[model samples]
Target: MTQPTIVFSPLQAGVPAAGGALEVLVRVQAPDRPTDLATAHLPKRLALVVDRSGSMNGQPLQEALRCVTHIASHLTSQDALALVVYDDKVDTLLPLQPMRSTDAVAKAVAGVEAGGMTNLHGGWLAGAQQLEGGTEQTVSRVILLSDGQANHGETDLSAIEAQCREWLGRGVSTTTVGLGRGFNEDLMIGMARAGGGQNYYGETAADLYDSFDEELALLQAMYLRQVGLKLLPAAGVIVEMISPAQQLADGSWRMTDLAWGAEAWVAVRLHLSPGMAGQTRDLLAASVSGTALDGTQLQAHAPVLQLPVLDAAAMQALPRNETAYTRLEELAFAKASEHLRQLAKEGDRQATQQALDVLEKRFGHHPWLSAKIKQLRQLADEDSEMMAKEVRYSMMRMSRRLVSKEEMAYEGDETHVSESVMPSFMRKKVSEGKGKKREV
Candidate 1:
């Protein structure tokens, strides 16, 4: 096994004698090994639950079909795909079958036409049912695609999200793709968060294809799924997950899964009671747990984090982890962008600029963070709704993944992903200048 590295870094090198609140940046980075690629990527099983409602009567339906076909055409013989379409009613267009040929699925896709209302929950549930009893070696997921709200059946948002979480425990994950602006972003994103999967949105056929491509690349390079993180604070220390997290039944914070050579992290804010002067102390304990590709359970526990208790002068002389502070800034920037989105939606331009100014003042010193602030500033003025979706979706992603500045920028503007963001494994899948074709 290519053991993952989990490190706990304090914002300051050492704790002050009079401790109150301490923030720790926790990172779980998946090892990137060329040899692990062959061992990590086993066969995959996918269920595509597509919304074929009345609202999708034209271009929407066409693009969806095109995307389904595109995905089917790319699957290897070792993979399996199941198709389900829902409107007012639900139908399984195709049962789970190996991908030796796309002929059968193609015919099934051709027969699909836009129907009545959007039974979003029913469609997703049907897709999950198809992947029941998935073993450890096979990666199973449901790609729930929708263009509108669910009004016909099981429209309860909480119920739907809970089911997604339940299915995740059964070895099946869920990824939601909102076809257009009309789809319920909250519902789609909520299900993904709870189900321990990804949430994405696209406006066109090319955009959909791009989203699908990213997902496939991530899956093909995955080492573990349903990754969870837990922090054990020492006596008198209270810990909170600053990053976005879903509370599991067992109380651990569930994060996005791990891709080989990639990183999943959580920013934790620790509150500590006062410690005795001139003493060394252990701050907290942490563990990263997940299911490996072949169904084996794995975990990595971080070493006991120890810091020396120092007096005022000594604490002032301590060196800070500059890199760790940047993570806190990243978290702040994400939250600020979300605030800016809400202000923009309310048509409060003055407050929006004020918030942007605050972000610029705090994060503008760094060249990279400054760029993001300006990017959000311009986006708020030009398109608030699009900016809203980007920030919300980004917050969900950032809370789980340890992304770089380039990746963050790509979330707001995909025109640069092919050139700036993707890893080596994804370079071939997304060609140069492909982002230009995308409307995002």
Candidate 2:
């Protein structure tokens, strides 16, 4: 079997005879989930950071404790766990330790209760501190559960996001969960983006379970958490990437993570020059860099895209790549949702309607997207803010993972997530989503 590697697929069948521009969608695929290989995955180190502020006094706090417990119950002996909760002051419910047993951790979680105000920053910082000894061998993540905005200390979104990015460089990534409508969606979403982790949210306390389960499933299926691509375009070709990517100091663009048995993609528009119709030429060369499933460094080159030149009319007559079309549309939908939310925030109802109308006209061909159009319109007419949060969360997920149409419709489906790497105790949640007997 071939080792899973990065691959590039273009939307166009071939370059036009008078080629001026074209589009391509790059995909990175992992062949299979880590199976019987014992060393297939890195040791996971997770910190459960919960906000025990006044807002989480009742069900939120209770469910949050349950969420922490849900995450803790599944770790393998090689993995590690820590617990931190904060309001005006921070508290470490459980010090960082290897997952030898959940007994002591259970006792620590039992006496926890809600406290005062939201010192969101302090809690997250404490969580990172707990994982301070993390090295390249361990995948350290701080899963924060919060129910309110940062009102106590260091409330600036920019500064918080910068700190999260700094921690990412130190082998610590932050995954934030927002419970209820009270927490700042912008901050939660932004922090996750900078910290190199996926952002998740729920409308009620009960929804926290799904968030925790889905996150754990993804972690279990995680192949490459951080991937960067350097595009070596043909001379004179100008490229514009549609995906939200962070440019590295080395000039490569950081892209979304690739999960086991799934594909991660980025859409790009390229400006090309005319070529002869009889000959095919390599238009783009790409090299990928990231950590593999076993924590081994990965560096490889994808096959070059060779396109056949064609005449203007012939090229225009070619059929669109259905896959690329759907991906481009998905990217457009996410962007429209963002724009609609911003307009709604400005109190410009007319502009919001105009945006929706334009979106409908643009994506009116796809029935599913048409449905989204209607949903966005309804939300704009009624609760635009709610629509904004919900759609933005979906956008965050789309940007981080390769979302299938089924996952898009259902929102939190983890049936395909593998439990091959999870410990016997922790593998239970893996079956809850889609009951499957595992070899514990």
Candidate 3:
């Protein structure tokens, strides 16, 4: 049988869009074969951490157990699998052991029991330890699941973040999954970001199985490791990574959550020199270690996308224009402006307040921005630590939107406030009972 070959093709490039941005499209392909591509043995080590807190006693625990069993069954005897369970304390049910022994794997996963409080830190530590030692060529990873907050052992979130950073530095990737509504979404997402992996939300036990299956499928299909793009733009050209992820120590950039499935696409923006005519320039180069399921490594290189630098006059002369590029440009500007606003608020409160005021006066018609300003004002007034943290968490999670009315209620609480709850005192008059008070 012939081995399958993966290929990528450039679809489009250098098209002027709204806000003076350009769009590039590419397609990835893998030739069809008979046997499962994922059945091949790869030098990969996976640590599975399950939440066995009291809240997970029933359906959650059962689903997690089933998921781990399925994961183990899929792995070749050559791969390694470690199982860790955490509640008030962390315990490794199965150390870094080969997945080839079905009976041993089954026994390890079947022993998981639920009780006590959620100790996320301990679980992470245990998982990190399991992945500590590996050959330079091995791919180490951790899959963590939890259904509640970390209230038992080492509740310091910053410390946990620092640990994750350290682990990623050592070439171990950690992905986190929130099992239910009780789990801290912000913490899980932040940990995933810090650990250089992905975060997932599972609303129910069934969802847990689905998430596990999806993750396993992706892992099996990975033909490359340490994949990254190095853009060396010509003079007067600027290249920016649209996706917010850094290259790993192995020189491969971990794909962000945005580019997970086969259907998802990755995008980048390029700024050209002014008054420059149509001239082809090397946009970027992508490098990935092509590896088969059996751990055989090969080198794969993507040809640089040649971009034409068009002058302003020439841009205007281009034929029937599509607004896709313009929309992307607008999205980029909105994202950047929101980020700046957040940084200003964190770094200098006074400057942030002034900037908010100016933005409100100028773009007050934008409902989302307007609503965010109102929320900020309300947070500033109430001076409630919990509310402030909640607002900040919401902003970080919903950065794509200036305002998200769906309030993220405090953990173990169900109360929620509307976006209109906090009116901007500067722009609108307060209402007394049934009537709106006139602004003086």
Candidate 4:
């Protein structure tokens, strides 16, 4: 069976009605064997950093404890585990200990207690240390759980980011789970990106379990690290921004924007020179490759280029002609640019809303997308910030309706109201709207 190839497209917007200078064509090769496409067998090292702050004194704390215990119990003798609990100061509940015995694991998990301020930095630093010792391991990971913003220890976000970078440089990946709204999603998100991992917001204890499952899956599957794209345009071809920009290194490109245990796609744009009379020209070329965390090699080639051929008369008229190809190309570029701008805003609600509105207006008639927009709007109405954020993220991440019903329900139920059981009145209203639109 051929491996499925996934293609990421740049978000486009505001193409001129005519005479645009850019065009984009995307080809995706989604990996085959979805079950383990990204996760092949590898040695695993994990550190679970939990926030047992004073605010997590009740249900949250209990749930967090259960989560840690459950996760520890699942580790095998070959797997290594570390526990870091923090409040005002970071505490190393368990050093980088091999999970060779269940008793040791139980003892480490049982020792967790809730108290003090939220010292995220201290917790992260300690967790980093645990994994640092396992540098020889192929797949190393960190799971950071926090219930509130940083209030103690080093509160500077930049410093925390620097630490995350250091760990990533050593082939360590991190996934962050935010418990409740008290935690800073931006901070967690940033930390995850810096470490080339994913981020999740857990509104309840059950949500935390789901997050843990995902983290486990990622740790088990990650086969690549520092995956990058280097675009080398044919002479005279100009390339623009790469969508979902995590970083544009001086010598390479790096992105940690992909979801955990999931593949991510990026879009790139190229500009071509105007065709000469009765002539054709090549436009661009790209090479993509990445190093696995375990030092495995994975790569793909993209020599496919778009060429424009024009006759003598057509070439003479190119400067003044308004052609279908030109119009479509302009629209595509505009759409891609706007999409990148919105994504880069990073947590700017207003900008996201505006972008959504534009997408709806343009593609609202598409049945699937329309339904998703409606469902997303419902989540937004319920003031489920996390769900809303997921909706936005999903749209950008997959560029399709890849989000599952269970995930939606998980997000909606954060308010304790089952989205599946919508009120009769609201259902009736939707039905009526559909009826009216059909009649029209």
Candidate 5:
């Protein structure tokens, strides 16, 4: 069978022979279809690290237990699950074991009581240990749910992210779910990216349940593994990529997993010095390598990107691929969104508005992005904490697979806003609409 294709969509599909600089977007995608997990034989190694800090003593803890039950129902005997709970101390409530019964697992979760400070790092690391030394064929993930700030044991965000990155190379990824408003969103998002896993936001009990279901679907559909890209630029050409790639000492780049349903892409810009006109030369040669679901090693080289040296007028006449240009604009919007958030947090209203204007001018036609911009506007008056969380989640979810159901719940659905921290306008709006019937 043919391996997945790595397609290069150049900013200008046909480059001029008198080359200057070229931008290309690299996309890696499998044949798109519903993946059948039963036949795939991809065993799962999952660790659920729950934060039982004192702040979660009531509804948050109860809802989290229910979420565990939801996750357990979807697991099969071929999957191994470990449950780790943390307060001031870490406890492995369920050692790594094949899925048994949902009732049994739920019962164990129900018995967990919330207490003490949060040892966030300790809890997550314990869960990671359960999934250590996993094979490429096994999908290993550490799912961490926290509703409180870390107060005990290795609370530094960078330190935890570094540890997660180290473990990801060993075939383990970490997914973080931030419940309610107390947990530090930056730490959760940073850790997820470092570990090459997904992140989620849960505003309520219902959102938590939906998040679990969404995550389970992605887990079942996992296919690609240890995916990396190698680029060999032709002599006199320099290449630089802006996506999540690690540059090796030899100038190659390494990218992580690419799933079937969710495609992976990298944005790269090539620098080329002026060359003679009326000549054709190879710009760059690229190849991608990864392991397939059937334990087969896979590799495929993209068609070489070539430069056609032509006069300025001829180069201008060459047709530009509209789709490729749009992809570049999308990337620009993603970057600007991040910067916009920072400016807003710093109270630079003028710069923030300018960033928003740039986004509107470039991407206003995009429905998803337009809606996202609207949401960002609502967050403008929020404190730095809320703005950071909302912005990070907004930008991250746009580029990746769907965030858990809680975030995109039906329109008019009740949003669980924190009463203590929410601005008066939002709190009043939520209170006023508490008992209204509106179409979702």
Candidate 6:
């Protein structure tokens, strides 16, 4: 089996003689060989948890059931599957069992009807329980679909995060899909992060299929799990991670799964103290540990990058990595967007506007981002819920939006995935650019 590669890009030019800012871009490349889904044959234990709240009575419920049908039809006999539906009460539509016959599962999904308020916690927990009986070698996951807030049975965000963390500790990952504008984006995003899984947004009924298909593609292509990075920063240097994670007590961060032919990048800003002139010092070091696709342990260390404290002129003579700078800009925008969204969620209109003003002053030159900022400011004034949801979705999918055309393309004969799977905001942003320079 091929091993993943680790590369680090530090500040190209040396630091100022009296010490200056430092930023490092850490990129983890997937295995050298492309993933072969037919050959990999990774077994999956999947739980499909669908919300049947009153709001999903019409097209929403129909679309959800149709999507689930598509997902069921693609499963193999070796995979274990469970279906759960909830609306103020939980119902196990189909008990956990291997997919030897999908007809019964599809029939069960078709019989679900929408009613009552959402009991998100109960539904999600029931789904997680179904996977507990699966083998340790299976890739166990819960695909949670919801179109409303948690109105019954443990609605608190903290409580929900704790519960999800408990499930993740038991080796089950939960991937959350917010069905429409009515869903609470913050709650879904938080739950997914705590579960060490992926989060998605479906703006319209038609969008549900895209979210379902993309997630399936990822699962079928995933090659690594238990991904963790140990950062060994040089003494006296402070490290601040800009990625979503569960920070360990020892200062390391826990990451999610890594798929084949995909790249995971982590960005960290280093705060350094001034050193004596004409001397070199180690900036940072990192080691990656994870479980590979073939059920083998994998470990790789990134090269240590050293910084030189030199004259300002000498530092200016060095070449910089333009790609690294672009990636950093993307990370900064994502961070600011998240902060602004949180402010909007709290109904602090003034603070939200102030944050937007600051971002405009910093990134107004970029057309797409500037347009997005303006759109968000208007939404904040008119509808805070919409603004918050938009911000979270945009930031969550930023990396996918910035990927090159080749990276987004698929080589397999999966002809059903012809529709655009990107979020609506991303589509609009890409269309307005007219081939302008991308900030990410």
The CA lDDT of each predicted structure is 0.76, 0.73, 0.55, 0.56, 0.71, 0.73
Evaluated against the true structure, the overall lDDT of model 2 is 0.73
Among these predicted structures, which one has the highest lDDT? 1
lDDT of 3 by residue, 1-440 (tens): 22222222232434332224454422222233236533454466999999999999988888678767767766787789898999998889889987777688677767678899998889988998999977645668898988889998888878888788789767677888776556776688778778866555555545444345445545544444333333444455475655444655664544432111221223455664443355565655554443433345544455666655565565566553222332233344345345434544365556556655765675455444455456655554444332233343333333221111222222221111221342111011111001111122
Clashing pairs in 5: 17-308, 17-309, 17-310
Name the candidate that leads on TM-score: 1
lDDT of 6: 0.73
**Positional deviation of 401 in candidate 6, in angstroms?**
9.2
Deviation in Å, model 5, residue 112 alpha carbon: 2.1
Estimate the lDDT of model 4: 0.56
Clashes of 3: 9
lDDT of 2 at 200: 68
Per-residue lDDT of 377 in model 1 = 73
Error of 5 at 260 (Å): 2.8
**RMSD in Å for all candidates:** 3.9, 5.1, 12.8, 9.8, 7.5, 5.8
Q: Sort every candidate by lDDT, greatest first.
A: 1, 2, 6, 5, 4, 3
Residue pairs with clashing backbones, model 3 = 17-326, 18-325, 18-326, 40-293, 41-293, 77-100, 226-252, 227-252, 227-253
Q: Model 2: per-residue lDDT, tens digit, 18-97?
A: 76778788876666654564345557899989999988998888877877877778787888999999999999988898
Backbone clash total, candidate 2: 4
lDDT of 1 by residue, 37-59 (tens): 65554688999999999999988
Runs of candidate 1 exceeding 4 Å displacement: 34-41, 347-354, 366-369, 402-440
Candidate order (TM-score): 1, 2, 5, 6, 4, 3
Per-prediction count of colliding residue pairs?
0, 4, 9, 19, 3, 0
Worst 10 residues of 4 by lDDT: 431-440
Weakest lDDT window of 10 consecutive positions for candidate 5: 424-433
Backbone clashes in candidate 6 total 0
The count of backbone overlaps in candidate 4 is 19
Off by over 4 Å in 4: 1-40, 101-103, 135-137, 256-263, 293-301, 310-359, 363-372, 384-440
